[model samples]
Target: MPVSASYRWSPFCVDGVTTVAVKTLKENAAEVEKKDLLSELEVMKSLDPHVNVVRFLGCCTDKDPIFVIIEYVNRGKLQTYLRNSRAERHYGNTHGKSNILTSGDLTSFMYQVAKGMDYLTSRGIIHRDLAARNILITDDHTCKVADFGFARDVVTSKIYERKSEGKLPIRWMATESLYDNIFSVKSDIWSFGILMWEIVTLGSTPYPGISAADVMRKVRDGYRLEKPEHCRRELYNIMYYCWSSDSNERPTFLEVVQMLDKLLHTEMDYIELERFPDHNYYNIVNLSGEKL
Candidate 1:
């Protein structure tokens, strides 16, 4: 079973102007593995659509080469965008119109991710591979969650269950997830914290000098990634909260949205969110889980 391969068409389109991304099993994948890929695709299709999530247009899994068509994000991966933007910020240091993100822009990214995360958590999905690299950016700077290859329905799980085994992104994972393969919403929140750090630092790699093996030991010993040098203390606090060893204490994605909402207001012009109730907009969802 070939575990790696993908095709991206330079001129792929749905209606001439409507661009899209098409995903399918690696051409070299064994016939036995096709079923696994199709099953996962079906699970992803069951998820309700949301702006924060990469929309799936359709799929064809009836035969040899199953394919799933999804939305095409113009700017590509969030990590790549941040890295390029960061370089541009240093090269010219342009103001007002530079692609460099302001604190306001950072908050916008956080808000969108949280909104999408809230939707996922609400629907019982656990994105085991949540990270900056898994997020796609559009030309308008809209961010969407991508790469659901590791997602599963863990909405009713009281505690994370260790994975049987797979290649996990250890750097962006929580301590429990690392040691036990256990995963849950809290695990996703931990990865979200790392993603936030990436955004604040304009795409600095997480744990620059730490090895995967040492990361588990360090985190278990109360070691957490320090705040990005340019991150505001308030925003850092939220990231810290997400990294709590007691997963039960970590705030739900909804709480994350509310806290980020407050920060966004403080950092820039406040806008009313019609989706949330006006009177109790700050009502945070407190999911019962272990504290990290």
Candidate 2:
């Protein structure tokens, strides 16, 4: 199958068990971001591979069309799943479904993501872009952080300085990054908050209809995206803490994992009810394993 989109790349099935997504940096392509792609490759190479990270199998650089070979995820992007979930919740009949992600499923996914980030952090790598779109899921319902296209090696001082010079996703960026273009492990925590929000909100657009500049302004002015009605207060509070203006105030990735663990393991009747209103909500069903 060939993935279709206007994002300047296509995914093709390589074999029954494997597929490859090729991101080409061609001379004739319009607005080629060669540096960005190369930087991503460099970052991916530096970090040790983990199951929670999309594996970098190989690349094709000698040919005219430079391409990076990566492990293909059969399930596609996390954002796609979120959008589907949102649609099901809003319009579809979700009774007796078996594959839908419940709060527990989300917690498991978050833990996996955190484990991946923790591994990256231990290796002194920072995923500069940590958004729903950048995360990919597998056939077995495992979550992996992908799209190192924006990642940077933390050990390189010059790269760190350059990365700190701005370059952030406005809506998902931490407040400190918005103002100073500075990112440390702490700023990543802020991004994690946004990621958590995305998972819970079923991939709703962050700061919807707002310009990047305006998002920065509002964030600086102590504004944050409102929690959805179904969002748990504890989870929302955790997200709020992650968005704290002071980068130092944000929790570490391990801390985030612990918090999430607590939330997932401890059965808080109120929070559970608030997060999932009806029995039908938790039973929305995940149809990913079935053949489409």
Candidate 3:
């Protein structure tokens, strides 16, 4: 599914009906070479089943390339789906994507994401990468958090900081995270804000017209993206709160879930779900339908 230019993973359906995905590494010393891989495998294997979270099937770390098997979400990335839906509507090409997510659909999907993140943060797990593209959708309109390629479990009560050098999604990063390389549930909350924007805008690029190198400066200068034109005022208020300069000012995922629940105006906990692939198959597209 993903490669190690910056990541590694594989998603395929063995039977063409039941889908499965995996993360593999040279079995030789995978546990040693990439200790994170082992930790990730453990996280995957240990996750308690949840409606909003991706399901882990099994893993094989004993061989040359260790294998981490997980339930394959057929609809693929959320960003691509949004983009395609917008495009199909624009061009009137109602083939694979005709029905876009309604307000209720958006609310439910975001609530699911919040629930998944709350589960992880409650356990002190940090998803270093949190973005719409990392989220997957099933055929039945279920949103499942996917792609732990950059996830980590916080072993310390203190902040988790790294000194490594690599490219990162600057637009989606919190100010402290970009400057200090410190990651926490707070940083994740900041990312959740950006993710909400994505969902609201139907996959609009964050900080459009800004270069990645300059995003830090702009954000530092208090330049947050304005509310999406069609976004509800109440939801936009939540986004604003999420982008608070102070990490402590950001709401926890649990709080987010509660807020969304109130907005959704429902006490219902879960819904019936079924799995089906998105109509945008074979063209693994991005926010703009560009081939990945």
Q: Which candidate gets the maximum lDDT versus the true structure? A: 3
How much RMSD separates candidate 2 from the native structure?
A: 6.7
- Give a tens-digit lDDT track for model 3, residues 2-91: 334423566677877776877776445334436666767776766788877788888886764667788777787887887776665456
Ranking by lDDT: 3, 1, 2
RMSD of 3: 6.5
Encode model 1's per-residue lDDT on 99-181: one tens digit a residue: 75666776789789888888888888888888777788887878898777667766566455754454457768888888777
Tens digits of per-residue lDDT, candidate 2, 11-116, equal 7777665667777664554333566677777877776679898887777766556687777787878877866765675565657854556777777777788888
What are the lDDT figures for the candidates, one per model?
0.72, 0.69, 0.73
What lDDT score goes with residue 207 in model 1? 73
True lDDT of residue 187, candidate 2: 74
Between the candidate structures 2 and 3, which one is better when assessed by lDDT? Answer: 3
The number of residue pairs in model 3 that clash at the backbone is 6
Model 3 TM-score is 0.83
| After superposition, candidate 3 runs with Cα above 4 Å error | 1-17, 25-36, 93-97, 266-292
